[model samples]
Structures are given as structure tokens and as C-alpha cells.
Target chain A: MTYVKPLPELTHEDRPFWEAAREHRFILPRCRDCGHIWFPPYSSCQKCLSFDREWIEASGRGTVWGYTIMCQPYVPGYADEMPYNVVLVELEEGPLLYSNLVGVPDEEIRPDIPVEAFFDDVTDDFTLIRFRPRNRTGE
Target chain B: MSKAEFSGRTAIVGIATSDFKALYGTDPERTREDLATHAIRDALDDAGLKKEQVDGLITGGTVHYEPLAYRAGLTDVRFCVDYPSAGRMCPMALMHAAQAVENGLANYVVLFNSLCFRSNQVKFGMGGGWMGTGLLYDSVYGMASPGAQYSLAFTRYQHLYGGTEEQLGAIPVAFRKHAQLNPVAIMQNSMTIEDYLAARYIAQPLRLFDYCLVNDGAVAYVVTSAERARDLKQKPVMIGGTAGRANFREWYVDLDFWADACASMKRDLMDPLGVGTDDIDSVQVYDNFSVSVLWGLEGFGFAPKGQGLEWIQDGRIELGGELPINTSGGMLSEAYLQGWNQHAESVRQLRGQAGPRQIPDCQRILYWGLSALPSASLLYVD
Candidate 1:
């Protein structure tokens, strides 16, 4: 795994999301008043418009929603990883996370495919959570 | 206000566009000049008015100032405004201009758009001082390409809807198929669902075909009172309703869905226009990306959340489907000149002037535009 520097500055609103990456935990915000979980950790819940929220750890289990196979290599750094599968994985908690699907061929990314998260240690500082197809084995 | 409240009042009296082509060779300022001039001439000819009659001008020039005054031949227009609002917000400017006219503040208003910067930089590497605000905080993430940002929504939609990748691929296939019939479309070749599914991915969840073609082109429109429309060459399609919307930010936030985009459009624009999605026979949806179209469809209540893929795959949005969308091939097949062509195409359909790709007896058109922002309009002819 290779480390990639985020091109933009990290703001206070999303600082927790990036900070959690160092500890290898996928963290998000949960409304303190309504008990609703928010992804990417916002200051308030879009539902009740309440600013009271807490950081909640997710189960990290979700299903592959939809994905696309990128042919053109626009970004110079990831050109070697051309035609990679980028997917949106829907967490059971209701927030959708944008991630890359690893350990699966580009053809396998479809709707409702069971998936789970695994950490990709790109570098000591930057660790990305990539999803992989869940195998139902020994049942 | 009611949707049809502006009936027999505001009308698009003029329309013009540049030669739709790749943006590699020409400078953005030159292309803007060509398109703005063409539109000005067309509007003057249709309205039977001279340059001196034009009193208002609005341009999407927030990033750069070259095209606003110097490039566009507007020497002494009374009211001139410029902003870096998203390309889709151009109609909001027109809506404002219409109200200005209704208030008797201006006689004639011009709205201009030029989309030639990206492809120019791609063909030849970007030179000094070409950065804009969108590239600042929004596209700061290296993975935040247009395709990548929209993929967040597409992924969530498919997760909630039970749609397969092949189903999502079907959208581009259908768009390209319709493009084959539109002579103005930049991409005229036939594409299939298999071809779409098989294409390589640009960002995760967004395939090569799922994105829009970036090219150099410009579009302009003139708005005048309905009282003055009958004196023009073509039948004036009345502007029934128009509204602009914005969220906290357009970047990839946690909740991929744009709730404001969904609610305000229904309450402020479409419902007031006296036409629901069913009442409108056709649409000129801004298809900047296949995913953006899906978002618009869901937000505009064309389909339920996550059901856009199924609606598209089941042929509900095809050319002859119950509701035909992007009849002008959309930005997906046509040039993505900031989605202004869709506005021009909607006017053509409303005037009964769309030659081959025209829908039969179409009296209403819903034009939806999306840049880094969202805005919509409903047009009708009686």
C-alpha cells in the first residue's frame, strides 16, 4: 500500500474523520439528542437540526452499493492502478461511504454484494479503509 | 408564487451557441467571444431590435474576468453582473433578469455561458494563474474529481435501491443511443449496456462512460417581456417558473443526497408551473454526469430514492419512454458547455422547431441544470 497526501487542507469539521485514520478506526458523528449516526462526522444531525452529537464507532459491515470502472488514468499517481473499481459501500447504520473495492476483479462490483472493511496501511500516517467481498465460508 | 404565474410575461427572445468541438486549440476568451457574439446577433435578429436596445447583461464569470466585458461585445449595457456561480445557475440569472424586466427596470436581458477551460488545460498543460474557487476547497482531495464526487451519490443510490452496476451502465448506453439521432451531439456513435459495464473505471463506482465529455463551447439567451415576444422570428416559449438552490457545500459531504435540491424544486418551481413530472411530456435534464442525472431525477421526484437505475433500465427515461429526457442528447452526448445547450434545446422543443429528435406534440419542458451547484426551470407553450 502506498501513502497518498490529501491535496486539500483538513478543516475542524472533518478533522476527526482524518484523525481517526491514524488510529485505524472508522469514526463518525452521532447526534447526542436524537441518537442518529452521521458519516464523515458532522457537528449536527441533518434530521433534527441539533448540534449535540458524539463520535460513534461503526460496525464496519456494509454492502456494495454501486461502482464504476475507471479506464482513463487522469491522476498521475494512481495511473499504475488504472481501471480500478471505485465503489460506494452502504453501512448498516444508514450512511454511505465512498471507498475502493479491493481483492475483487472489476467485474464483481454489483448491487447488494456483502462486503466488510479492512485497513490498507498506505503509510504510518495515512491508513485507508478499503472494502473487500465477504466470503461465507464453513457454514 | 405559482408555477404558471409568469405566463404571457417572460420569454426567451434570442438563443445562440458556438461550434461544438474539442477545446484544445482555442483560448477560453476567444471561444466566449464567438458564442456571445453569435447569441447577441441571433437575439437582435429575432427580436428585430438593435444593440442599443439591450439594457441588461449577466455572465458566469466569477473565476475570470476576461469574457465578461472585454471578450463579450457589451460596451455600454446599463446593468452588467458577473459571478462564479455554478454553470447550472445561469438560469437563476435569467430568472432574476426576467423579474428585473417585469419590474420595468430593464427592457432586454442577456445571459451568456462559456465552457472551454478544462479541456484546454488537459490538451496542453495548464499555464500560470488558471486556478478558480471550485478548485480551492472543493477539489482539494486528490480523489475529488467530478466523477469521484458524484460516485458518492451513485454508490449510495445503488445501495438503497438494489441496482446492479449493469443497470447503472444502462443510462450511458441509452444516452449514447439517443445521441446517434441528434446531429448536434458530439458523441453520435451507438453504445450498449455491455459496453458501459465493461468500460474502465475513472473513480470507484463511476465508469468511463458514466462521466460527461468536457469540451469548449458557449451558449447565450436573451430574455424579454412576453408582450414583445410575438414580434420575434420564432415562437416565444414562455418561462413558467425558475428557482435556484444551494446547500452548505456541494462537495462530497457525508449525506450524499441534496435535500434542499429535492424540496425547493418541488415547492418553489415545478408544482407552481402547473405541471408535475407526469404533466411534462419531455425534459432537457442537465446530464453533466450519468450520476448527476440520477440525482436530479431523484431530487425532482421523477423516481423514488435509489430507483433511478431501475427507472432508467426499464426504459422509463428512454427517447420513447413515458417521459423522454435529454431529448437534445443532453450534456452526456452533447458538448458539456456548462449545460447551457440544454436551455437552448428546451426552447427549440417548445417552439416546435426541433426537426428530427423532437418529441411529438410536446408543449412542456423541464430543464434541470447542475454545475458545482443546482438550479431548475419549467417552460411551457400554449
Candidate 2:
């Protein structure tokens, strides 16, 4: 089997983010002073510059804010995944996160479509957070 | 700043360009060099000067090609600068060149860009490395191409302000119709709102027609003080004012609704240029993607956020509308030389020399660099 490399290694600034994502939790920095969630996991809030922070779990349920169809595969190994959808998903909690939209037809993807979290296990150490169309089944 | 104005200081002394539609057919082909040669010659000829007279040069590249000063043979020039904002870099460089002339640092500055990307380049993945980083973050997650990046902006714009796809398509359709009068445009493919809406989606919310073409061409300009421009060959196109603004990171910021750089440009560029939205007689807002045109209009205060689409469709942005934008068909119709050619066209419009596509008494114009990182300049025929 061809091995798929996980996403780029996390830097010191964003290590908390990747560590939380490994456990299927979407983590963001909650400023102790301003009570705002920071994106890409920052150490301090630009608003208050407060170093005191807390990690919060996101609802992982949000609307499709915007997206791109990669007609050209960005990664050489993922050529077979040509025309996959990359999207900016606005989590219900208030942060805009980037991920691939899966399990749906390309034409059906539109603005404000509700989505829920899905994970990809590329390797033993890596599990990526992607999203798919919200459950349509009544159950 | 007292609202920067280009009124009577620096002028376009020369302009040059090569015929745009060349293709890179093979592996050893050098399309960048081809575009640079065309633009450098046209700009020098327009100014009635030679390569040896150039004291400053600025260029941008794709795929890590040869730099402009070296390839265009502007060697030994005192001021050499390269702007790598891709298509946006062209106008940014011109703004710098104009500043150099106004400051007495350079007598004549040449600004140029050669834009060409072959289909095979994508097929073989030859020059795809330039976008690899974007792929890792933005692209990897779905902001795949320029269309996708702009789509994110458009969506956020609609979320906050309410812009529709049909309204969004109006910007390109207006320019495409305007382009019909020019012979230089590539995608002369007749476009109507129906045609645009019916077109395939390159990225969600951005159809194929809504995107600008990747054509093979080059554009260039020579800037010098107004006093010396009179002695040159062509009518001096005065540089009224110039502004350059860049966002922190397009992917990080919501371009549609939250355009801080664009807002800064309005205060810094328009105030100093001494022209309000109504003062502009004609314009050449970059159309790298149609949404960019909308963002530029809103950013420049020509229209409010999300209302740019309505302004475009209501016949206000057409050739005979309140404002005539992209008279040389802009990047949508004529050539997408990384918006370098937009500057040359501004000079042509100000000179009343844009044959066949000329706007009557077209003076007092505004030229936007690109949408993502807003940069702008105002020029006039004084």
C-alpha cells in the first residue's frame, strides 16, 4: 500500500491544535480576559493580548461558508482525488476552519449547507478532521 | 497625507508591449522571457527611449523564471525591483516606479510582466510548485484555486451583505461585452448573464466565465517626471496618484466582508489623489476573477459591499454607464498579464489613444491592482 504522509508537522505555536485534533476534538484558544476563541490556536488574544487561555471543544456543526474544487490536485500523490472539494467551514462555535468536503456530489455543495465532522485515518499516528453533508436520515 | 495626487509630477513617458497570445508548446519553452521582451519594447517605444535610458526596472515571475531586469536586458539600471504578487505585482511595481520618478531617484522606470501558463504545465505538473504552499493549507482544505479563494470571500460577503451569483456574474458579462470592441482579447466567447450562469463551476460560487483567462502576453510602461515627458514621443499621461495595499493573508481574512487593506486604500489613495468615487471618468479595475472587480468597486467605495453586482448589472458599470471600467476589455477581455497591461491601458485611455475602444474625453481615471491585496493608482491626461 502506498503510504500517505500526514499533514505537515505542527509548529510550537499550533501544537495544541494538532494534538487535540488527533482525538477527534476541534480545539481553539479561549482568552481568559476577552472570552473569544482564537483560530489556528494562538497563544495570546490579539484583542486583549492575554496569555491566560483555555482550550474549548467545538460543536463541529456549521454551515459551508465557502469552498474550492481542486480540479488540479495540489499533492502529486493525490492525483486520483482530482476535483475534490476544499472548504472553509464556519463552526457553530465561531471559528472558520479549512477542510475537505466529502460524501456528496460536487454540484450539490452550496452555501449554508449544514455539515458534520468526519475523520480520515491516513496512518496510525494521523487522523485528519474533514466534513461531510449533515445527516439526512430521519433516524 | 493630504490625499496623494499624481496631478502634475510624474508622467508615462513611454509604453511598450508584445502581441499577447503565444503558447508554450514544449518542455524547453520559455514563455516568461517571451512576455518580457514584448512588454519592454512596447514601453520603451511609447516613451521614445531605448533600453539604455532606463534607470529603474521592476518585474514579477511565475515558476521561478529569470528576473525582469536581467531577461529584459535592463542591466546596469540603478533601481531594480521585482514584485512577486503574481498578477497583482504588476501594478504594484508601476506604483513604485512612479514614486521613484516623483522622488528624483530615477529618470525613467520600466515596469513589465509576461503572463503565460500552458495547459501542459498543469497536466505535467511542471510549474505547479509555486502554488504548493497554498495547496498545503488553503488549497489542501478546499480553497483550491484563485476561484475558490475568491469564492470564500464572495460567500462571506453574501453571508453578511447578500450578493447573488447572477449579480456576481454581471461584472464579467459587462466587461466581456465591452471586450467585443477590442481585438486583443482572448476569451471573446460571447457572454451573457444566462451564458455565465450556465457555465461550469471551476469553484463553487465561481463559474468558468467568472474567472479571467490565462493568456500568453506581456505589458510594460516607462515612468518619468512630467517636465521631461513633454520631450518624449507620446503625450504625457500624468500620474495623478498611486496606492498599494495588501491584506495580512487572503485565506486568513474574509475578503468579501472584511477588507481592511481595501478600506485603507480608500482613505490613503483616494484622499491623496483628490478624487472621490464620482470624479473617476473611466477605470480599469483588475478582473483576475470577476469577484475581484466587485471587491475592488466596494473597496474603492464605488459601490457599497455586495452592491457592486447590482451596479454592474444596472448598466452603471457599462461603457456608457456612470463609470466605464476596463475600457481595454480589462483582464477579462483583453489580456491578463498579471494586471501589468491594465496600467498601459490606463495610459492609453488618458492619452485618448485607445483606438476602437476609446472612451470620449476619457480622463481622470482609476486603476486598481488586484482584488486580494488591494493596490491602486489614479492617472489623467493633463
Candidate 3:
């Protein structure tokens, strides 16, 4: 089926990060001066405010920082996918990203569980990072 | 921390709010302007003043200030401005108005926030897709609404601090109890912990009751210099210290749950005001989501950091408890006038106009908007 959910409107600031994601490379902006890597990609380093920064690939491993089950499809295109989990993953590299938790039943999801990211190519133009349990029966 | 020069220099002299019971598709449905003009006239009447006396006009939430001033006959105003939408902007608006009143820029400032959900379909945290919230990220995963964002914050709060669903349910239940006393509160139905738990989730970790009411309503308050406010018909609620407002756009709430920031504001800004939480009689934390109140309690020092869930277990925040919170039902049961209603409730509380919900001998009230930026609070006293 075609991906009907909303897609991130590509912008000039974060194009490199998304383009890298398109290549199945989970990357984030890292400041050369401050050694800080942040998400939702900013043009400069969030910590040092220095425009001197570079995009670096992340480890794609993280724990479920927090999550909530969408009991209702408040917006369009998610009615069929009702009861899905909207999750925040705190990356091993120390940035938070919003994604869905797959390969784990909704009933079993809990906080601080080990998970690794996998690129789900929703459409030809975009690839979303989703997470699944490193061990299926892991807590 | 609020500017020292403007601290306690201005006062909220009169306040009024439109009825949310008359929502859209009901008889006498109101548009944005109708509600704005009505609230302006009523607030002026409440202050025992006339339209001609309004020298400053400040408005917010999609209500353009120029047209609103024209409708209210605030023709020659020294200060005429409008803030962008969102309940968080309410306290910031009050701050600017107080500065104007203190610096002699305006003798009287009439500030208001009016939102009509009936006429405009202001979607909740659902904006970032093409409109509000996120610029390029988040929406792709359907994480755009304020409720969705707050769900993450609340979930993180519990995971790091240790809390339970039953503990989370206590907030909405308490707000509903207070709403029962508010004559014009929208959600008059009684709520209990069981009811809160049984309620479905709009977003996980936070139940349906945790979200605020989105209704059509207008809240207006007349502001004046403290010297002028003393002569008004109503007992003025003097603006005291302010825990200066800050905007944190970080993807996740910091580990301290904003406690460190609140502490900095207290030490640098509010400490000089001489009236901390110890002197407060009532509290109105901006309850955009019931969790925001929990954040306020802990961040504002009412409860030990990371122990808000347990602190509110008793009736500490109820109408007659050690410290009353959201006595006018707040946004949960009260009409969601953005964050304006809480400020109005403080004014009402100090003036002994809250009726059955009134806190007796209430001389000092602390109201803050956790929903705005991380937080901003204005301490008001009679």
C-alpha cells in the first residue's frame, strides 16, 4: 500500500540529514568545536552556537526514552493504523528522534528498553527510522 | 524573573470571561469579534470604567488588535498591540502591559485573549505537518499535537521520577472537583480517580481527561498602574514578582523537569520580590494538560522535585487544602481561554468574587503558565 501518512516537508537546513537517511545512513549534525550532536537537524551546533558543524552517522542504537499509544487517529491517514505507538528514542549518540516501535506488540512496550533503528522507506523520496527490540523477549 | 522596575508596579483591576456553554451550533453563537467586543465592554463595566477611558489595547489569539480596538471604541490608545495565539503567551502579554503601565507609556491597558474553536478549526498538536509546531521533523511520525508532545514529557517525568497512573489521575479529578464550584465552568460533571483511569487515552500515559477543553470563549482584564488601580471600583490584585519566562525548544524536556530553570528564576528574579511560595494562598498553574500542573508544582517549589505525583496525593491543591490550585476549575473543567482564565481567576480570587469557589481570606495568589516556553509566573496580591 502507498504511504498515506504525513511526510517531513524537506527544508534547506536539514536536507543533508534526510538525504543521508535516504541512503540508509542515520546521520546527525555534530559540532566540531563542542562535540555535540543534535537532532531535528539545526544549521549550527545547538550547544556552542558555532556554524562550524558536520553531519555524522549515528550508531542507530537507542532505548525507548518515552512513548504513547495513539488510541484515536486524531488526524487523517492513521485510522487504519489506530492503536500504534508513537515513540521517542534517545539515541546512543545522545539525541532524541520521533519514530514508531515495530517488531514489538503494543501490549508489551515499556520504558528504557533496548532497541535499534531500521530505515523504513515509506516512499521513494523519504525513509523513516523505526525501532524494534534488539531481543524480541527483552524488557 | 520579572523586571525589578515593573514588579508590583501594575495591577489587574477588572476581569471578565465569555461563557463556553454557548458553543458553536448553539443559540446566539458568537464570532471572534463579537466575543472580543462583548468581553471588552463587560471588563470595562466590571472595572467601573467606560470605553473612552481605555487608553491601551492589547489582544491575542487571532483577534487582530486594530479591528478589536475599533469595535470597542478604544479609538485613541497609547499602546495598541496583539500577541500571537497560545495560552502560554498570556503571562508574557501581562508582563509587557505591566511594563507599559509602569513606564508611563499608558495610563490604562486593556488586555484580552479570545479564541473561537467553533469558527476556526484550531487543531491540537496536529499543526507541525504543514503549519504549527515542527518545522521539518516530528510530523512524519504523527507527533505534532501539543497533547502528543506533552505525553512524551509526562512519560519521561514518571519514568525518571517514579509515578503511577493512579497518581496521574489525581490531577484531573481534583480540577473537576474545583470546577463543580465555578458557576461558569464548562465541565460540570464530577470526576474521580476511577473515572480518570477508565477514560481512554488521547495519547498514552495521559488520559482523555488530562487534556484541556477547547471551547469558544473570550477573557478580558483591565490593567492599570498600581497607583491608579488603588482607586478603581474593584479591589486590585497587585502584580508582584515574576519568574521570568523562558522558551525551551529542545526535543525532550530536560532531566530536571525544568526544576533547575525554575530555581534559577527564583534565585535571580523572584527572590528580590520577598514573596515566594511560602506567602501564597492560591496557585493557578497553566493546566493546558493536567500534567503541566504537576510540572508546575515541582518546578515552582510547591513539591520536591520529582515528587509532584506523590505531593498532590493529599488535598494539598484543593480549594481548602494547604494551597488551592485551579480553584476556578482551570482549563480542564473551566473554559480553555488559553492561559487567560487562570490570570482572571487570580484577580477574582483576590477580590472575593469567585463565589462558591472563593478561597476565604485569600490575600496572595501565585499563577504560572508551565505550558508557555518552560514556564512563566506572576504573583498577585490584594
Candidate 4:
């Protein structure tokens, strides 16, 4: 069986973030002036409100800040993936990113668990950034 | 000009709620406008004020004041305002209405909310309707519903605080105990910690029992000057002090910062009332999800930080406990009216009108509108 999930409606500000994920490298906007790093791809820095920003490649390492096992499919596309894990990762650089935690059982997932980013090319046009335990690699 | 002037200047003179359970799985015979009109009429009758006397209109959550005024036969409305996106600002609508009345913008104001989620088949957490830039990150990852959003926060809370599902189970159990006494509560069936633990998980860290009932209902309140309220039909529940604040912009990504956010509102609300946490006899914390109540308990100074689950385990939040919370069963057991039911329960408790579930000699009640981003608190005095 095939599944089609809801896709992100890309805007100019979001395009860079999604484009970066396609290459299997994690990146976020950083303020050149006030030295603040932020997520969700804002043109200006949230702290200093400065447009002097750059997209820096992140370390692809973060700790599990929090997570949940989606017991029910909120969207029809997730019907087969019942009880999947949705995790919030606090990137080493400072921003928290929302993604899924794979390669770990739901009960083993906990806050402060070390994880690394991995990419899933759901389609040719879109790629999703997911995470797994820092120990194991391969899908 | 200052908190001193705002305290006790405006009062809630009348309150009314539509039948909560009756609207479940029912057909859409009443539009949102009709429900709003019905609640307004009921509130007007409760206050013994005619429709012509209502000079101000304020509403939130999909209610337009213009059409509601026309449907309620309110023609002399002087000040009209509508907060269409009032998620956590639900209780602040009363504060805004009070400000209008105090500023002489209007003499009488009706603040109401009407939601028909069941009848309209509105699924709240499906994501996609109003996608702001900030929410795009989570929406794209299948994290659409509010349950999933809040689960992230609560999961982090439990991890940091070291809590068990059995400890969290106490919240629903206690609320259901209170709901059993509330004749109008939608889920009056007795719930125990065992039942809560056994409930199917909607989102891990949050089960079916943790979520609010999606039923159709409307709640309305009439606000007027305190002096004018003395001549009305019911004993007035005075607006003592109201305060609200939003966390720094990282609200969506950082869940731990909510403790400080809640603490900020707590100080802002209590300072104006010239009272401390000890002065509040009862509370009506927003319980859209059970975790919200936990945050409210800690943020509102009812319990020490990171000890809300322990506080509930000690039975301090139950009826006949130290602080009787959600005396009308709250959103968990009561109907979900976007925290409007909490406002009505606050008024009822302050007036000593909450029959069997009434906290003995309730004097001052605190209501917290705890939500994801923006949060508000109200101090009501009898």
C-alpha cells in the first residue's frame, strides 16, 4: 500500500530550510549582528530584529527535549503509522526542531536522549528531517 | 490609571450556559448566531436587564458581535468588539468588556462564546485551517492536533519532574469526582485513577480522559459597573484584578519556559487585587487538557514548582480539599466552551450558588486561561 502525507505549503522564507534538508544537512538562520540562532526560517532575527542573517549548517546533533507516541492518526495519511513518535529536539546550537525519532522503541524514548538527524526523501520534491538514536545508523 | 482603580470597578452581574450534554451528536437546529442569541437572552433575564439596556457587546471564538446584537435585539450597543482568535485570551474578553464599561464607552456589556464543534463536525487538532509561519514546522511533521502539541510539553514536564501515569491519573479522577456533583457536567460518570490509566492514549503522555469533551454549547455573562450591579437581580461577582502576558517568541519550541510565563501572570493578577495566593478561597484553572491544570497549579502559586502532580496526589485540588478547583468539573468533565465555562463557574462559586459542589464560604476565586502561547488570569471577588 502507498501513503501520501500532508505536505508543507512552502513560502519563500520556508523554501531555504526545506531545500537544505534535501541535501541531508541540518541548517538554521543565524543572526550576524546579535549572534542569535533561530528556526522556522525567519528573514530577520527574532532577538535583535536584524536582517543581517546567514543560514549556517547545524551539527546534526541534539538531545530529546520532549516527545509523544501518536496513538491515533490525526490525519488520514498517518493511519498506517499509528503510535508513531513525534519528538522535539533541542539542537546543539539552541533552536528546538520538531521531527520524528526512529530506531528506538516508544518506551525507550525519553527526554535528554541523544539523537542525530536523518533525512527521508518522501518524494522527489520534498524531504523530511527525522532523528534516530545516536548509536545506530542505517534504514 | 492603576490597579487600584481597576479593582472592583466592574462586576459580572449575570451568567448563563446552554444545555451541554443535550447538544452532543445532535443536529444543527441552532446556528452559532442562534446559540449566542439564546445565551444572551438567558443572561439578560438573569440580570433582570432588558435587551435595550445592553449597550456594549464583546465576544470571542467565532462569534461576531454585529449579528449577535441583531439576533439578541440589542439596538443601543455603544461599544462593540470581537476577538475572533481568542485561544488563551478567552477570560480576558471579560477584562476588555470591563474596561469599556469603566471607560464610559458603554454602560452594559455582554461577553459570550458559542461553539458547535460536534454539530458542525469540527475536528480541532486536524491542523491546516490557519497555518501561521511559526506553526508550519510542526504541521508539516504530522503534529497537527492540540493534543500532540501539548503532549510534547507535558512529556518534557513529566521527564523533568519524575512523574508516573498513576500520578497524572489523579487529575481526571478528582475532576470526575467534582463532576458527579455537578448536574450539568457532560461526563458525570464516576472515573477512578484505574479508569484513567486504562483509557486509550490519544497522544502518548495524554490519554482520552485527559482531553476535553467536544460538545456544542454557549456561555454568556453580563458585565456592568459595580454600583449598577448592586441594583441587579443577582449578587455581583466583582472583577478584582486581571493580568496577562506572553512568553518570549520561542514559546512554540521551548516548553520549560512556561513555568516562568505562568509565574509572570500570577504576579500581575494578584498584585492588583491587593491579595496573595492565600486570600483565594477557590480556583477555576483552565483544564482544556489535564496538563494545563498542572501548569496552572504551579504557576498560580497553589503548589510549589514541579510539584503539581504531587499536589493532586495529596487531594488538595479535590472538593473538600484545601483548594477546591474546577468546582463545576471544568473543561475535562464539564462541557468544553473554550474556558468560558470556567468563567461561569468562577461567578457561581463566588456567589455561593454552586449548590452541592459549592466550596464552603467561597469568597475569592482565581481563574487561569492557560494555553500554548498566550496566557491570562482573572481575580474575582464576592
Which candidate leads the pack in lDDT? 4
How well does each candidate superpose onto the true structure, as a TM-score?
Answer: 0.77, 0.83, 0.93, 0.95
State the TM-score for model 1.
0.77
Better of 3 and 4 by TM-score: 4
Which DockQ-derived CAPRI band holds candidate 1? Answer: acceptable
lDDT of 1 by residue, A8-122 (tens): 2356666676668658887778888888886555566877989887787877788876565555555445556666665767787887766777887876667677888777766
Best by TM-score: 4
Candidate 3 vs candidate 4, lDDT winner: 4
Tens-place lDDT digits, model 4, residues B97-155 = 88998999998998989988788987677754333643366756777567777788888
Q: What local lDDT score does residue B361 receive in model 4, on the 0 to 100 scale?
A: 80
> What's model 1's overall lDDT?
0.68
Error of 4 at A95 (Å): 0.5
Q: After superposition, which runs of candidate 1 have C-alpha atoms over 4 Å from their true positions?
A: A1-71, A85-121, A124-139, B1-4, B21-30, B62-67, B70-73, B122-142, B159-174, B177-181, B192-199, B203-206, B245-260, B294-321, B370-372
Task: Tell me, by DockQ, which candidate is best.
Answer: 4
Steric clash pairs (candidate 4): B125-B145
Go through the candidates in order and give each one's DockQ.
0.24, 0.35, 0.55, 0.61
TM-score of chain B of 2: 0.87
